[model samples]
Target: MSAVFEAMIRFGLRLAGSQFPVFIFPLLVFIVFRWRAMFSSVRENPAARLLLSYLLVVFVLRFVLYMSGYPYQGRYFHPITILTVFPIAGGLLLIGRYIEKFKRGNLLAWLVLAVVAASAGKVLNPPDPKKWLKDIPDAIRANAPADGRRTELISVVEDRRLPFYAKSGYHLLMPIFGDMFRDAEIFLADGASETGKKLKGKGASPLDLEGRKGGIKLIVRFDEPTKLRAIAFLWSLTPDKMKADVSFQTVEGGDFLKAELVSSNQEGVVFRQELTAKNIIIAIDVKSNSLWHLSTVRGHGFDSYQVFTQGYYNGMMKWLPEEDFKFGLQSVTQAADEWGGDNVFILFDATIPEVEKALEERRLRGKIMPVGEFTTHKGKPLSLYRGIAPDRRD
Candidate 1:
């Protein structure tokens, strides 16, 4: 309980520090000396008492809600900051009095002048921004006209700043674009993946273990003999069949090899071992007379996309916002198929061959124009393009 509260305090402080200037020392001094005086003043003044009570109640309520498992951001503290204006003024006045008592003359004046000069430094010598996409919104606004046309855009940039920064009138739809967008040389169980279905393998899919009782056998074969590092499976079991004896065998119908178990829980199981083999056989023997189901299987030697996709199926926040996007998970081709807009903005690194082919197939590439080109933090080019919808004449 102490650790959770400590973490909440640290998180709140860290967020506040990033968003606003921290006058921690002055606030601490005011609290140390004038707390009793503040309470007495509040008691004498009804408005002050009400205001203080409101501030404390609302501020504590927000923190309590955050502690109760609500995700909070720095901006959520704006209300409390607004309510602290009078208290901040009081703290500044106390500091000014202390400074006067210490020096007796031009000390307060000199401090005010110093603060003014320091504040001026922001305009005179501004610090360089660390974000590569900071200028993207302005660039988009400059190029894309706000003609009141209903515009729908798809952003693969993985940053929400574009939508927040860009001018209104355009609808931004960001698909699940992250590590899954990267091309993988091999993604295991691709054939088993049901079209337009999530985590449901079909036919002879090793991942399909629904409505099964007793022991289950799964065989996964690679295109060629590949070096293996880790293999993971995600499954659900009836409460009665909580335990399952899992083993891996490289040879067909051969003895199972003892691999090191990396992780095991109700969610799934993971095994880590170094082996070069074309195929692997997984054997699961249930300890009870109940049903067990397997949803996903991932291997490390192949593409990391599969591993991430499996994690996504097993309830990882692989998608943006860590909540539902109101749209199904889509590939570049799939998103293009569903797009019904005249003008489309692709705000990501869409210079890859696969993305290019998808755009070309939809005839969107024929009249594509570059909106902006900027270098990513990784030294790679991040290009934004505006694709006009295909005309019926051609």
Candidate 2:
């Protein structure tokens, strides 16, 4: 019953899309007026006809909701779409009975007017999915600490406009990007085999994992000693049945010992462990059968991969507000400092001006570097921001 209700709601939103209301309103009026004779057969006994009419009205209302991108149980709501349409649908249904006595031309004109009004109302308010995605990076960059040498860094990517099938497959790009930061150690959980292959074949330099399954590798470079932090920004908006895991490994030739699981949510998991040797590996595993096929088998240095999940400055802010951002940063920073480092490389997205401001304020300019652009699950380009600090020099 709940599922049916949910379905009904979703259907309404789908039907409320810009083009749908225009098409549906006229058809609805026509159905009501054209079927009046049929409807009137039991007008004296209106219970059956009324029930059918009510159901029809409910179906149409649900259709409008569906077209407007309002999912069943969606957290966000577009006020104009719902507030305006619901009343209109109800009023039209009520008027349909009275309008049956009017000329067909007048009824048609009324239908046209209702559609025009609905369209105008909807057009006046548009949902900004892009703006929402863009804000995440901005917030992260803003609160980023200026003392890049002392502050730890993490990056998150949130892209919601992806095709349903591609959503799970895109997380595979995380590790591929993680391999690029040479100044500090990094880890990524991605679900894209194509990205892994590209990273392995490119021979870019930072990634240097040999004889590893799933193209997992570690890049180590020398910089100032500092702290470390972890940030998880997810493009998979549907978090109901997702699991993420981050594991640390001590690479002894070819085998791995599970070190720690840092963070896990419906989207994925992140874990952090100290790397004492040059040969170490971090694996981010997203537990979803839908993503397993994207696993990679080889490792390489630098190659372009499809960014299923890319790190960005602005996008992180959307997921983590200022307070949470500070905490996550402090987590990595403290960890790096305890491990005896003056600098820690923080991987993030560059499009966020806030992150840049934070870094500048902390006087960590030399510590910051913009790596590359990552594509969202929708295939839009997102900037890659990285903060590089090592433990010994600072």
TM-scores, in order shown? Answer: 0.46, 0.26
Candidate 2: regions farther than 4 A off: 1-29, 36-114, 132-155, 158-384, 387-394
Candidate 2 lDDT, tens digit per residue, 1-394?
4434654664555545533445456445555664664456547667646655765676566544443322244322334344345434544655654676765546745665776797788878886455534443443344344554232223333233221212111222223323223223233223343123222211211222321233232222213221121122111111223223333332222222112122233322111111111112122111111111111221211121222322443343111122221232343333334432323223343344544565466555444455444444455444544433453234
Q: How well does model 1 score by local distance difference test?
A: 0.42
Shift in Å, residue 134, candidate 2: 5.3
- Give lDDT tens digits, candidate 1, residues 1-394: 4545664676567546743353445566677788998879898989878888888787777766554333357677777767655665566667888889867887766765655676576558856553556766766666554454433345544355665676422332232222211211222322334121221112122223222233333333333332142233222111213334444444322332222221223233221111101111122201110001111122111111111111242353232222322232223223323343333565554344544565566554544455767766676556665544445213
Which portions of model 1 show Cα errors greater than 4 Å?
A: 2-4, 15-22, 42-48, 68-71, 116-152, 157-342, 349-372, 375-381, 386-394
Report the Cα lDDT for residue 11, model 1. 57
Give residue 390's lDDT in candidate 1 (0 to 100). Answer: 47
